[model samples]
Target: MAIESYRLNVAEVIEETADAKSIVFDVPADLQAIFAYTPGQFLTVAVPSDQTGLAARCYSLSSSPHSGRHQITVKRTVDGYASNWICDNLKPGDRLRVLPPGGIFTPKDLNVDLLLFGGGSGITPVISIARTALEKGSGKVVLFYANRDETSVIFARELTELAGEHPSRFTVVHWLESVQGLPSLEGLSLFASYFGGYTSFVCGPAPFMKAVTTALKELGVPRELRHQEKFVSLGGNPFGDVEEVLAAQATLAEADDADEPDETEQPAAPAFAGPVAIEVELDGSHYSFDDWTGDKVLLEFLESKGVDAPFSCREGNCSSCACIVLEGEVSMKHNDVLDAEDLADGIRLTCQALPLSDKIRISYNG
Candidate 1:
């Protein structure tokens, strides 16, 4: 079962800044539905690599879903393989292998007021959210974008034009580190106080994200209202056949599971021994299965049942397969995205989840 991927033609390339470029894809009408994405979701691209055959990378889409365009902004990193490859090589009419849109860094409700913070290249997804919310949603949008300097701002003209077109509902505050120094905790807290009621989304360098999340927490903002996106390089090639990738991953997972626990660490609970049952809710539909044998992970089991479960980077490194546990319990073999707060809210990565109880109920509605 190979994951579906498409070869899309590059329709255009726009130089956003000295080190950034936006690649627009020309998705065919037949694949339109498969590529359709919510604002802030990302596309996984397979960049050519001599050493590894191809290097898979996830890039956030900057174009709004309503815009009928698939675009991803890439900024050159000092020694980045994929980013540099994309910026240096891609051109109009070039074809690239790309996975369908996937990711959970999106606003659930466009009608809610949005407080957005984007630092440098992090603006990629934030702009998508702002554009979609402004055009298709009835809510005010406030953007706090930070950059190294004015010249490094990626979408200066477009952002200015958007602000001008939606003057009453859209506002943007530009922060240049060269001019104002790096944004401090106190300053970020003061700014966020003005929109305490709005749903906040932060994507940036690590320090910037930490400051914003800390500020939101200090303001007593609920966990549900605070969202942040963390960028990590994929360790495996997701463009490979899915079964091959899963087989390799299972070998590593088994090796890890065989290791003895450290004396200081608490022992994990035993897994459910017999066949299990599960009830799931997704896209307003209900499904139940009574034959889960506890041998396969949740996502794999669901796929075996012909359930169209949402997933990307099935290695548990992304949140596209996150689901909330409604009843019973499950354990994750590996997780890199969800935090303590997310786990407290019953959010589990379905790709890594294994049965811990006889019966479980989960929902992808959230």
Candidate 2:
């Protein structure tokens, strides 16, 4: 079935933290079936920029599937155009355009041990995954969450209560910057006891996630056992905000598949030189974008053409915008999601890709 977007009415707005807020949406009875989702999926919401609040951005759903109302949390960004706007201006009774829940960051099976890691607001999805795992009797779930200070931590009380409720199944350790700063290399040794037998899921700002990724690496955790989730549009940092280390982690799959970049042949990141024609396939429908030159990325261009497609994190950090290129060449300015195997199979990030050749063929249903 084709994934669809709907305008769900805001039911309530709850302040989760000093800078963070969760907006509950009133999903109609008719839309509930489509809105139903797994543990770690996210919603891409379009809150209008002006009075109507019609602009869009992706936010991770903080409320669990067990919760009645569907809600996504937002941390007010300093100069965040979309996040700050939504925090200050959006409220209950207002309508926002929303894409149904979708994302790849979820618990795969029950037999594996689980170790979850989150930094700052990145805890949103982590909590969802952890909560669901506990309910299902998934093997021991442990979390190492990082934050700048006590107050900055999202879901702090809920996490503690959850831990108290399921002491045998779950454990949460907080790393506060004011006390000890980010988790350190020395700290990785302390968690080494659980290192060999767990699947590590890490999410947060680039630097924080990289440190977690590195700690996992030093602990001898295998690559396949690690899942990395990065927030591009962070509160202090805006979308597409990434550091060299974090960017490398996002592309690590690509790098590992190839293993080594030819020292002499390192390639510059690619981009579409100019406007080009594109063909798109969504659901079972086909559309040609002759009107859209190469002015914008593929997803934005298609949306402008009135095509209902699935996309989130316009920053290219998530697989929400991933598509398979059927023909011709396409270039991506930045990518932290798809790996080399994906590229080998023709997968590309439509949010970062621009049509390179005069014409390009792509499939969004992929």
Candidate 3:
């Protein structure tokens, strides 16, 4: 829903690899409940700017809830200026703006067969999931992690130690692309014997996910058994709400014919022109916006009107901006977070959804 940010101090910074590090937060006692999260959730960190302006990025929590500490592992992106900034500068005692844990990429049932597929830094949440599973000791935790080589793998040592500690319950497989080829359908299929009954959680770059899932489906892995998370921001919003919305002159476009979705990063929001009647209900308070449109997301529009609505990435990558449509219909530019069942339940993303009608009402307190 309307997620709020918290200022937490870095308590520890441990290097997980040559380019990746895990930052543990000193969460206040009063706010510990706010930060309590499921095994595969993530935290959105907002870094203040000196010359670059403010930058916000989401990092998955690598620590299990049983650890009673908040830790997120970040792998420095070679071309990502913000990532590079975090890797080079963020340290213990540094105060940073971080949103509470948020994400739906968690194990549905721990008692069932649990397998995780991660590539590169995507190992963060799966690591958490794996540890939590091992701690529970009721299910088997299997992880197939891929990286360039042993040198670049984050949490390489810790994961191995975990496997050793829980030899019977946990199994960790490493795919060093340097020795073997990059993760492919064939590479993934080799693990097929482990598939049919296991509930698979996959996260990585778009191609890796697509290739793996496609192969799984072809191998007869049921659709309901597989879950995926596209960790990057797919630009210009995602088609979140109504697939078919009123276009110019009120013409309807074919929902099934929408353009192929591109997977990460993005363009800026467009400004809305019309005088729109916007009513938002949050925390038992009501607010209104006079000018809003499909040009900009409801989150941006509300911010411009001084509503201080919740949001992280303006793209539909996370559930920070999720809201329930109360009175009118809206559509998102892109939607990877909410599925058909969620939409059917009236849940939608306010950061990506824009009002197609003149009057719209939404609530974030859900």
Candidate 4:
């Protein structure tokens, strides 16, 4: 089934920094529930493109869910097409096609003390998480935000205001690379050591994220307590008709399989041949099906059954469609985001999952 997209009016635009802008969408009341998102989730926008008709890009929401606003901050990248287009062309009264909120980068419990690290535009989601936690929960929030310089900091004023409002529970530590060279692994580890017990979330440039994650690992932070968001470009247009998207994806997968060498030492398990029985738990509801013929991916099958499973980039490059296998195994056609630890934890992307067992059970509660 084709994922639904909505046209939202650009309610306002705020110039955050020299190269960053925040676009607030005016979601109609009828669609408000569909657009309601948790902090750290993102919206996929269908940007107009002459070469491809439309370019789909995901932008993290910078507005707290409790603020009754749908806002996404976009920072101009050196040669980024979508970011540049959004920063230059979007204005009040303009309508843009956008997908509903989707992502797994949110905190399960708002009351848990959080230690957040953000770099450059990655501060967008971190601020949202911070704001929501401060306004709705009773926990401390510490943000270590890094920027090129003071002038390049997005949400500098807002963060200051939040700190002022919740001085006892919120703190902001700004790191300017111009003043103090790029953060070293030793420095990061030392700083993170102070908040050893807090749940840690990191989002930043590749190098920055690498340093922070490595530091966290060396600090012996449990895998469950450390989270990182990776920014990756979608390889396919998810705004297109669902059938067409799936067909194109299948062709691409076939080509990839043909060109890649088998790297696994052991032989792969054979796919289950008979009709399978599947069970899924999502959004506090349980669903079961007895005749899953294994003809389509799990997300496609769930949508066909009227289950509103979450998904963003169906290309397995994002964790929006992630679900945990509880009782049976499923094979992924492709995966770019999940690490070995995640797979060991049974986290599979529903968008690329195919049944490998006659009876399967999964849950999206996590």
lDDT agreement of model 4 with the native: 0.90
* Worst 10 contiguous positions by lDDT, candidate 3: 235-244
Q: How large an RMSD does model 2 have? A: 10.6
Instruction: Give the alpha carbon lDDT tens digit for every residue of 308-341 in model 1.
Output: 9999888767799999999999988778788888
Q: For residues 1-366, could you state the per-residue lDDT of candidate 4 as single tens digits? A: 446899999999999999999999999999999999999999999998765667888999999999999999999989999999999999999999999999999999999999999999999889999999999989899999999999999999999999999999999999999999899999999999999789998998999999999999999999889888887777677787644635766687779899677563223345566488999999889999987765688898888888988898888887999999999898887887887878998999999888899999999996
Q: Which stretches of candidate 2 lie over 4 Å from their true place?
A: 1-4, 50-54, 234-317, 321-336, 339-366
Question: Which is the leading candidate under TM-score?
Answer: 1
Q: Tens-digit lDDT track for model 2 on 1-366?
A: 113468788899988888888899999999998898776778876554442223446687777787766878889778777888877877889987777787767667745778888888888888888887777656888988888998898888888998998888889988899999667766854774565778888888877776777777777777668777656541111122223335565476666768665452323345556567778887799998665455677777887788876655555566777778998877776676765646877988876777778778888665
Select the stronger candidate by lDDT from 2 and 3. 3
Better of 1 and 2 by TM-score: 1
Clashing pairs in 2: 47-53, 48-53, 48-54, 48-55, 275-294
Residue 257 of model 2, lDDT score = 66
Q: How far is candidate 1 from the true structure (C-alpha RMSD, Å)?
A: 3.6
TM-score result, candidate 4: 0.91
- Which candidate, 1 or 2, would have the higher lDDT against the true structure? 1
Error of 2 at 63 (Å): 1.8
* 2 versus 3: better TM-score goes to: 3
What is the full ranking by lDDT, best candidate first? 1, 4, 3, 2
Q: Which ten residues in a row have the lowest lDDT in candidate 4?
A: 262-271
